[model samples]
Target: MHFLSTYQRIISRLLLVSSLIVTGAMADEVIMPPAVANTASNNVPTVGPSRPKNIIIMIGDGMGPAYTTAYRYYKDNPDTEEIEQTVFDRLLVGMASTYPASVSGYVTDSAASATALSTGVKSYNGAIAVDTEKRPLTTLMEKAKALGLSTGVAVTSQVNHATPAAFLAHNESRSNYIDIAEAYLTSDADVILGGGQQYFTPTLLEQFSAKGYQHISEFSELASVTTPKVLGLFADVQLPWAINDKQAHKLSHMTQKALDLLSQNEQGFVLLVEGSLIDWAGHSNDIATAMGEMDEFASAIEVVEQFVRQSKDTLMVVTADHNTGGLSVGAHDKYEWHPEVLHKVKASPDVIATRAIAEDNWQPLTATLLGFTPNEAQYSQLQSARMQGNEPLSIALRKLIDIQSNTGWTSGGHTAMDVQVFAEGPGARLFSGHQDNIDIAIKMFSLLPQSVQTP
Candidate 1:
């Protein structure tokens, strides 16, 4: 009888150990800490029946829930017992579907998704601030302007890029950069800060100056210019990835500048700030670049949080236009995550690609960037690709890194996954629960002061 009892105990103990291992493996796939609950009873504050005097909408381009999760783990090093809370974690209101019009299929592009968020209407892919039929639609910024409030846009990408362009420029196609730049002359946004200096030629600069707009390129010029109507073109095209250029004009600095100028308007302001390169990083499948961009974005949110505390009447909403890369945290081994390995990465794939293509060698560059020598198979594949000279070096490097890190990506394009939405201050309650992307714009319009609600 004693022997039988002992055997049963041993079996029970073994079963428990097996279960624990399974649970640990599952947990490793999603290294993010359990969400800090933001229930209405505890998390949300009591704001009475008052309309917000100002609205600031921040878009984390291509920032899906997975990106947020990956960033949280990356920033906090989730392997530790203590983890820090990200700004988005504290303010998470709800999730929003990112599907566009049926004609555009299930996965919405940046242009279509941004238009939906800006104008409360579903539009085909590639359409910018226009309906499916290519008709111009009034945007939240335009409405805010009509209501006598100042408006502005700040982004990490070119100002004429799809996401930012959807907010202020109406075009049949998002690729029409020249047309988009021309629209800015009539946009009358109080402040415009970003790259795309090439889009605004010398002639356009003179035209802007004639219309009481101060155009500046250098960061110093942007800082010193006190003019309310300012145009800051910081780079010839899209700004360098955050990881590549730390000293360049950062998104947080640009946000602060835009706020400074827009606040000068007594009638309040509506600003759209986008962490545009988060999408690009995802597209490149570069985890290091994504982390750098997310860190900058979090810094910008911190600035906005400070602004919200002081103003008390500002409605701040943060969301993503779409999910890019379909990035998954872990792949080969369910019980493993290697966020720390990302620290070893020093340069973006683009930089490495440029060098590798120039030198006609990939092994040395890959070793330097990844902090390890490539294996026999990787070296052979790279050599063959170089011999062929058809595949992009960046693409080849990204594939190699993806395998090395055990990171998984569905494609080099956007995904139809629902993205996170976080809101704080007046009318934040409207943002809770599952919602369509268009619902955000509708709710914002509804919350506008009654006097300025009309077109």
Candidate 2:
């Protein structure tokens, strides 16, 4: 429990620091205990060179300052317009950098960025966690296992997607789902969680009873498993977001279970958690959806905090690969129906999925929740799209914005600008400067005991 007490003190320190800063007070530090916080006086310690016993990298896909700020604002102020300290603000470290391999006035896709962070080397866009020749490189996960430590990867994305796939599977192309699935079977990562169940299921949808690998498809089935090498593919693909929940799979549940199973190994572990839908909502330019995704991630962070604050040697690096959609909070409230009307809509954003339930029902649903009288012209457009079996949340959101406020920018793609990184733990001091995505691997290994270092 020594580690637990130290971690709790660190979290409390962070909370105290943030609360102070939010109140317009500036303090040099919140003063955590010697074991929990990294002070300049204790840069080089006797704790095996500040190596971490456990590591967690949380990725908020396509989440940059704009998206993060908007979420923080709404979360801190759901009422008046007073935003609180950002999650980054409470971290021991913060920095930013680009996602691409070079500065050619270009932007990067998820694949290149994922490879860069996983392999400690940058590659062209669309490449998996491999170099130009397609040669497989050792990732942080692979290295951790090589040193007799356990590793795990969890995300809200399909397990075969670029981000999660980077940690385990290595191939020339990130789009090769079949190849990625094959790689997962041989990875050293002990606890694999999240979607892409169909990739392994043959035409007959076989179970672990018929395979060389252990597998589970339902949350209950997952919670009941006890095997060392377990893969919980909870959905055929990306599980529905919390708002929809048609599939009823819980992302936080999967993450918690992975942490519990991996932490039992005394050799230590490294885990990755991602809220992949933040990017999806960004692509659709939908604030309501993005806000909900952020809320879900916030809850997940709370879960990690409980465990993180218990382990003195664990480190948490929460970051985003890149920014999407140039999103900005509206500068003015264009809707004039009255504060009470807007309050109702904000209070029950759940009315959205209810809007999505039927053929032509979404129009009235959005109109009602938006505090606007139903407009025949707009309803006609929505009805036509629904008649053609299309449900572009973007259209409804655009209409909502048109009625409520002026949307400042537009996009469905990544920004050339850099993304932020936030770190918490003993040696988090290694994270303060602007850095390449590739440095993440090197810095982490530097924090680990020499026995755990890869050649």
Candidate 3:
């Protein structure tokens, strides 16, 4: 264990050195795979070209470097020796530090990090778009709306979730669901998508409708929302896990639809698209569900990548608010992490456990959902957990998968780890190298017209 820790430290130092060199070398240009580089427009300059007309901020909630690295391994083709680069790998230009205000400690909740990313100001944990004093801070979305450019949010979680809420509203606490939901009523954002139908009442729905926003509850209803203004709530609180959900690329679909609507404005738009549930999965230490969410998020990034490439006047920045779960690729002093075992997982552990608890023929049901029969020891663990309750059974299932995959997690909460940042299109070069979370929002503010920027 001592030797392994030493080796890991050495590798981390080497990675840091390599990162510095790559960042310095690519400061003036967007570095992508040869295939992607060839297709990029020559007109897209790193700097000096006028600011991008459109800006797309994609936040993968709780996605740290570990998550991306794990995704690479999980998605790798075993048939080939060389690992394939994901959309994240291709666009990754730099990294960012995620720390909230000093009052809240180094680790940040989704709300504080999102506040910093949206308002260019550090705020205490649980703060929405408010600073430590609970005062309102002008968010990027508000600025875009004031500039007469379209603004919107599209996320897999409720629109009022911490990340999206910070961009759209000002509140002292992220838990103020009613207040945040009501704040959305007054926001001029053209597109609002996600869940949280429980927070909105009949009167609030009528108010949104009166404000010219087309409100819909079903995912299928997205097509009928042709107007620039639309409110989509797909679930009562948050969407289902991607592993068990029928809509495999829900985030990608929502992002595409958002772009379609926001692009109608001649002045361009500023859109916030969040893979919100990646955090939730991470909190549960659910690797199978985490990979599924990452895949959906990656697909969404590809959609935006294509849009930015085609438009040439747009900037797309992808990052995470903070790290969650302290996820490690390998666990239990094992040198190997088998991502193949996770690929066969048909449903989340919770769902599998719930069904197993309800069904009489539980063994086959569990095996089918897990895509593998448990060994004698694992079977005993499952049986023991089954007697306890659904939650324990779920934990046991996760443990079995972790034992097979060799995955490790240190916490069920946020960590003080830096997150990777991926960018492309005009003004993208500005984000190269390491930066504080607030710096990300400040840099984006520079991309906006000077007239509307706060002094």
lDDT of each: 0.80, 0.66, 0.86
Per-residue lDDT tens digits for candidate 2, residues 154-225, read: 778788888888888888888899888877767757888888877875632343334444677776787786
Candidate 3 lDDT tens digits, 123-230: 899999997789898899898888878999999888898999999999999999999999998888999998899999999999999998899998888977777899
Which lDDT tens digits does candidate 1 get at residues 282-343? Answer: 98787778888998898898899899989987989999999999999888766555677666
TM-score ranking from best candidate downward: 3, 1, 2
Best-to-worst lDDT order: 3, 1, 2
Overall local distance difference test of candidate 1: 0.80
| Backbone atom clashes (below 3 Å) for every candidate | 0, 1, 0
**Residue-pair clash count for candidate 3:** 0
- Model 3 alpha-carbon miss at residue 352, Å: 0.4
Best by TM-score: 3
